[model samples]
Structures are given as C-alpha cells and as structure tokens.
Target chain A: GESVGLHLPTLSVQEGDNSIINCAYSNSASDYFIWYKQESGKGPQFIIDIRSNMDKRQGQRVTVLLNKTVKHLSLQIAATQPGDSAVYFCAERIDTGFQKLVFGTGTRLLVSP
Target chain B: NAGVTQTPKFRILKIGQSMTLQCTQDMNHNYMYWYRQDPGMGLKLIYYSVGAGITDKGEVPNGYNVSRSTTEDFPLRLELAAPSQTSVYFCASSPRGRFQPQHFGDGTRLSIL
Candidate 1:
C-alpha cells in the first residue's frame, strides 16, 4: 500500500528555537504536497504547500522542502512559538485533477515557553 | 469569511442509528472534502467532490456516504452506525487547482455507543 508517513510521532522544542518535522512518502506519482496544523479539538488548518516542480516554498514563518529524489518532505518553523504547538500533517495529491490529498499520520509539535 | 461551516458540533448516537453531518462553505469553492480523525491519529479522507454533481470515494469511505448537490454543500451520511465510525469529522473546501490549500471547518465530534 502506497502511503505517506512521518519520521517522528512527537517533537518537543523551546520557544524561539527552530523546529523541523519530516515526512516520507511512497507514491512517486504524487505531484503536490501540503502541510496542515491541527490544534486540540479543531480541524486542520493549511500551513504551506509545495509542488513537485519546486524544491521549497516559504510562508510567513514556515518553509516546506520537498526532495523528490528520496520522496521526502520537511517542514521548518523558525522562531517556534507556543501557538505552533499542535499536530502537523503532510498531505500529498495523487493526481493533477481535482486534487485528492493523502495525509500522513502526523507529528505532534510541542513548544514550551 | 466563515470559510467552511459544519453543523452539529457534537453528536452521540446509539448503534444502528443514522444521521447526516451538514457541511457548507461560503467561499464558493469548487472542491469539497470529508475526513475523519480518530484520537491520536491524523485525518483520513472519507469522500470528496470536485464540483457540483461530481463525487468520489476516498481512502476510508466504506461506512460513509456523501453527496454534492451544489458547490456550496457536501454532506456525509452515516447509516447503521457502528462504534468504529466514531470520530471527529471535518469538512473542507478548496479552489480548483493542483496545489490549492484547503479551508476546514471546526469539526463534528461523534460518539457511537
């Protein structure tokens, strides 16, 4: 079964530090990827996204790096804040049409002030 | 903008009961999706709609059903509910594109007893 998965289930970091979350995917046909943040008792919020054509994309304080060679993805958050504490998931789009995403298990980011 | 809204924030159902989870998006996005999240796990797609009158099953759609009558609404129905169906359900919408980010609703917490 082709699937996307996280390298770590949980990551703890101190405020003001940088945090990186990794994901590995098995589907080579996937062309698009996204990162989502889910807080306690809430739905997932879109953070950043990257296409297979590009190696990286940056948001406000977040960056998504894609390595098509190894089928790996990573999300980097600079100056990690307490609000960044949540479960982060990496999702991949299997096709070029309508964009149905396959989500990974998730990595819980714990930021302590 | 009330991007995406889901009704019945919480629900408790007995075995064999049936109910529909309402999802509406004011963003007028053409792509809608339904996903379920279990405790300590990431979200799994249940169903998705590319546009009005077009629907498709996702990763986990065996025990769920969905319909897309219009671009603004996509509801999920659960018939003969089982305990395994208990999870937090989220509705999301996104523009038509290859890598568009999805806007999600708060979620409906369902408990099957």
Candidate 2:
C-alpha cells in the first residue's frame, strides 16, 4: 500500500537555530502536501502546504519544499523556538474521487532553549 | 469563532461498550473527517463526509461508523469497543476545494479497558 513516512523519528535543535524535517511518500498520484504541528494533548494544527505544480511554499517562518521526482517533502522552520517543541507530521492529498490525506508517522521536534 | 468543537475531551469505555464522538464546525466547511492517532504514530483516517447526507469509509473504518445530517456536524460512532480502539480522535473540516487546508478540533482521548 502507498504510504507516507518520515526519515527521523526525532529531531533536536537549539533555540534560534534552523530546523529541517524530512518526509518520504510512496504515492506518485498525490498532488498536494501539507505540514501540521501537534502540541501535547492537542490536535494537529495546520502549518503550511504546497501543491505538485509548485516546488516550494512559504508562510510566516516556515517553508515547505516538495520534490515530485524524488517523492520527497521537507519542512524548514527558521529561528527555532522553545514553543516549537512538538510532533510534526507531513500529509499527502490523494484524490480518489474525493479528498483524502495520508499522514506520515511524524517527527518529534525538540527545541532546546 | 469556534472553528471546530469536539465533545467529551476524555472518555473511558469497557470492552463491548459503544459511544459516539461528537464533532461540529462553525466555519461552515463542506468537508469533515475523522482520524485516530496512536502514541508516537500519525493519524489514520476513519471516515469522511463531503457534504450533508454524503459519507465514505477511510483507511481504518472497520469498527466505526459516521453520518453527516447537516453541514456543521459529523459524528463518529464506535461499536463494541476494544483495546485497539483506545486512541486520540480528532475531527477536522475544510472548505469545498481539494486544495483547502483543514481546521482541526482539540480532540478526544479515549481509553478502552
């Protein structure tokens, strides 16, 4: 079955430093991708998204880079902060006559102050 | 605005018990979805509804059922609860477009013993 996965289960970074999270997807038919941030005891919050036609998209201090040829996606956060410590997930939108998102296992981002 | 609201922030159920997780969105989105997340893992789609009176099964919908009687509400029902059903459930809603970002609720924590 086609699925999405993360390269690292955890990522550690110091405050004010840059952090990057990587994700790999197996479905070539997916056209849209999204990044979500989940804090403790809360739901996943939408961060940034990019479409297949566009290779990159930026919002606030976050940027999402999509590589269709490699089936890879990456999220880069600038000036990491303590509040950024949480789990990050990447999801791919599969259009099966309807919209469906397939999520990755998630990468835990730990920012040290 | 209360983007999305989920009832009973936490719940406990015994084996064979049944319960419904309620979800409602005030944003008037046309797409609603239910997903379950286990510890250290990503969310798995349980079910989704595109509009009123329209529903479809997702990746992990075996023990779950859903209905969308109105555009603002989509509830998920679990029958014959088992230990495997213990997880964090989140409800999300998006606009009519396939590229729209989803707004999520806080989520409900369920423990089945």
Candidate 3:
C-alpha cells in the first residue's frame, strides 16, 4: 500500500531556534511532494513543494528536502517563531490517470516564546 | 477574487441525512479536489476532477460523491451521513502541471449526530 508518514507527532522548540520535521513515503513512484500548515479553525495552507527531480527546495523561511533513496522527506524551519506553531503535513502526489495526493498523519509544531 | 470558497462553514446533520458541500474557485484552475480531515489525522482525498466533466474517485470515496460540471466548481455530496463522517471537509484547486501547489479554502466543519 502507498502511504506517507511522519516520524514525530509533536515537536517543541524555542523561539528563534530551528525546527526540523521529518516524513517518509512508501511509494517510490510518487513524483511530487508538498508540505502544508494548518492552524486552528482554518484549512491547510500550502507551505512549499518539491519535485522528485530536486533534492532541496527553499522558501522564505522554510525548506523541503526529498531523499528518494530512503524514500524520506523533511521540512526545515529557520528562525522558528511563535506564529509558526501549527500542524504540518506532508503529501505525495501519485499520478495515475489523474493526479491524487496522499497525506501523512501530521506533525504538530509548537514554538515557545 | 476569492481563491477558493466553501459555503456553510459549519453544519450539524443527523444520521441518514444528505447534503451537498459547495465549493467554488476563482483561480481558473483545471484540477480540483475534495478532502476530509479527521481529528489528529491527515487529509484524506475523497474525489478529484481533472477538468470539466471528468471526475475520479480518490482513496476514500465510499461515503462521498463529487461532480465537476465546470472548471470553477466541484461539489461534494454526502449521502446518508454517518457518525464516522464527522470531520472537516476541504476544497482545493491547482493548475494542471506537475508540482503545482494546491490552494485550499477554509474547511467546513461537519458534525453527524
């Protein structure tokens, strides 16, 4: 079965510190991957995305690393802020006839001031 | 323009009731998707459409139905709602391409009694 999974259920870090969230996928055929952030009472927001062709992609304050050899993915947050606290999810797009996304059980990031 | 809009931000339904969760996007995206998020879990894809008049079932499509009659709208139908269906439903859209990030609407919180 194809599945995406996270290594941590919860992560706590001090403000201004760096945070790393890890994810793993079982489907090697997946070509695209994405990370999303969901706050309380809101929908998941797109954070960043990386295609299979790239090993690392950087955003404003976030970075996504894809390791196809181990079938693992990771999100790195630089200078974590209190407002950065939210649940992060990793999703893999499986292309069949149509594109479908498979999400992982999320990792909750808590930034403390 | 509203990136993605979902109506009925919250709803309570009795078992066996039927309702439609309306979703509309103004981004002119050709791909639309419906997902359900359970507590402490990831978003599960229910259905997706590539373009107008083309729809396909996703990983978890048993209790839900969807139609894409237009490029801007994809509605999800829940027939005979069950208690297990209590979750947050989200609508998202993306341009037709590999690694195109999805834009999501604020989810609808549905409770089944």
Candidate 4:
C-alpha cells in the first residue's frame, strides 16, 4: 500500500533555532502538498502549502520546499519558538477533482527555552 | 472568524450506541472533510464533500456516514459504534479545490468502551 511517512517521529530543538521536518510520499500523482501544526488537544492549523509546479513557497516565517524528483517535502521554520512545540503533519492531494487530502504519521517537535 | 466549529468537544459511548458529530463552517467553503486520528497514528480520511449535495468516501469510510445538506454543514454519523471507532475526529473546510490548505475545527474526542 502506498503511504506517506516522516523521517523522524520526534524532534527536539532549542527556542530561537531553526526547525526542519521531512516527509516522503510514495504516491506520484500527488500534485499538492501542505504543512500543518497541531497542538495538544487541538485540531490541525494550516501552515503553508505548495503546488507541484513550484519548488518552494514562503509564509510569514515558514517555508515549504518540494522536491518532486524524489517525492520529498520539507518544512522549515525560522526562529523556532516554544509555541511551535507540537506535532507537525504533511499532507498531500493526489486527485484534484476528489478534493482528497492524505496525511503523514506526523513528527512531534519539542522546543526548549 | 470561527472558520470551523465542532460540537460535543468530548464524548463517551457504550458499545452499539449511535451518535452524530456536528460540524459547521462560517466561511461558506464548498469543500468539507471528516478525519479520524488515533493515538500515535496518522490522520485518516473518513469522508468528504465537494459541494452541498455531493459526497464521497475517503480512505477510511467503512464505519462512518456523512451528509452535506448545505455548504456550511457536514455531519458524521456513527451507528453501532465499536471500540475501534474511538478516536479524535476532526472536521475541516477549504475554500478552494483539493489543493487548498484546510481550516479545521477543535475536534471531537470520542471514547467507546
């Protein structure tokens, strides 16, 4: 079965440092990707997104990089803050008409002050 | 803006019980989705709606049913609930196509014993 998996289950970083999370997808048809942040006992909040046509998209302090050649995606957070400590998930949309989005297992990010 | 709202923040049900999880969005988004998240597991798509009257199954739709009577509402019903169905359920909406980032509700935590 095709699946999207993260390279790490947990990440620990110091506050004010940069953070990077990676995801690999087996589905080649995935044309759109997104990054979300989920705090404890809360729903996922959208971070940033990128289309297959582009290699990178930047948000306020977040940047999403897509490497379609290897079906890899990464999210970079500048000046990681304590509030950024949460689980991050990468999701992809394989079929445009279906409006379907599938998520990865997630990576727990812990930022220590 | 209360982009998305879910009712019954937490619920506990006995085996064989039935209930519906309510989801509403203020953005009047045309795309709505239902997803379930188990402990230490990735989010799984339960069902989705492209528009007010169009609905479809997702990755994990066997034990759930959804109805989208209006663009603002999409409810998920669970009949004869089992322990396996116990998980945190989230409802999300997006303004654009499948490629758009989703706005999610706080989520409903369901426990079936």
Candidate 3, residue A43: CA error in Å? 1.0
Number of the top TM-score candidate: 2
Q: Show where candidate 4 strays beyond 4 Å.
A: A1-8
Candidate 3 C-alpha lDDT tens digits along B1-113: 88999988999999999999999999999999999887766788889899999998887899898989999989999999999999999999999987788899999999999
For all predictions, the C-alpha RMSD in Å is: 2.3, 2.1, 2.2, 2.2
State the lDDT of candidate 4 residue by residue for A82-110, as single tens digits: 99999998988878566677788888999
Candidate 2 residues A1-113, lDDT tens each? 22334343789999999999999986999988989999999888999999999998999999999888999999999999999999898888887767788888888899999
Global lDDT for candidate 4? 0.89
Chain A TM value for model 1:
0.91
For candidate 1 chain B, which ten residues in a row score worst on lDDT? B36-45
DockQ of each two-chain model: 0.56, 0.57, 0.54, 0.58
What would the TM-scores of all predictions be? 0.93, 0.95, 0.93, 0.94
lDDT of 3 by residue, A47-96 (tens): 99999999999999999999999999999999999999998989898877
Q: List the residue pairs that clash in candidate 4.
A: none
Which residue pairs collide in model 1, if any?
A: none
Model 2 compared with the native: what TM-score? 0.95
The 10-residue segment of model 2 chain A with minimum total lDDT is A1-10
Q: Chain B TM-score for each model?
A: 0.98, 0.98, 0.98, 0.97
lDDT of 3 at B63: 88
Which tens-of-lDDT digit does each residue in B1-113 have in candidate 1? Answer: 88899999999999999999999999989999999977666678899999999999887999889999999999999988999999999999999877788889999999999
List runs of model 1 lying over 4 Å from the truth.
A1-8
The residue-by-residue lDDT of candidate 2 on B1-111, one tens digit each, is: 989999989999999999999999999899999999877677889999999999998888999999999999999999899999999999999999978888899999999
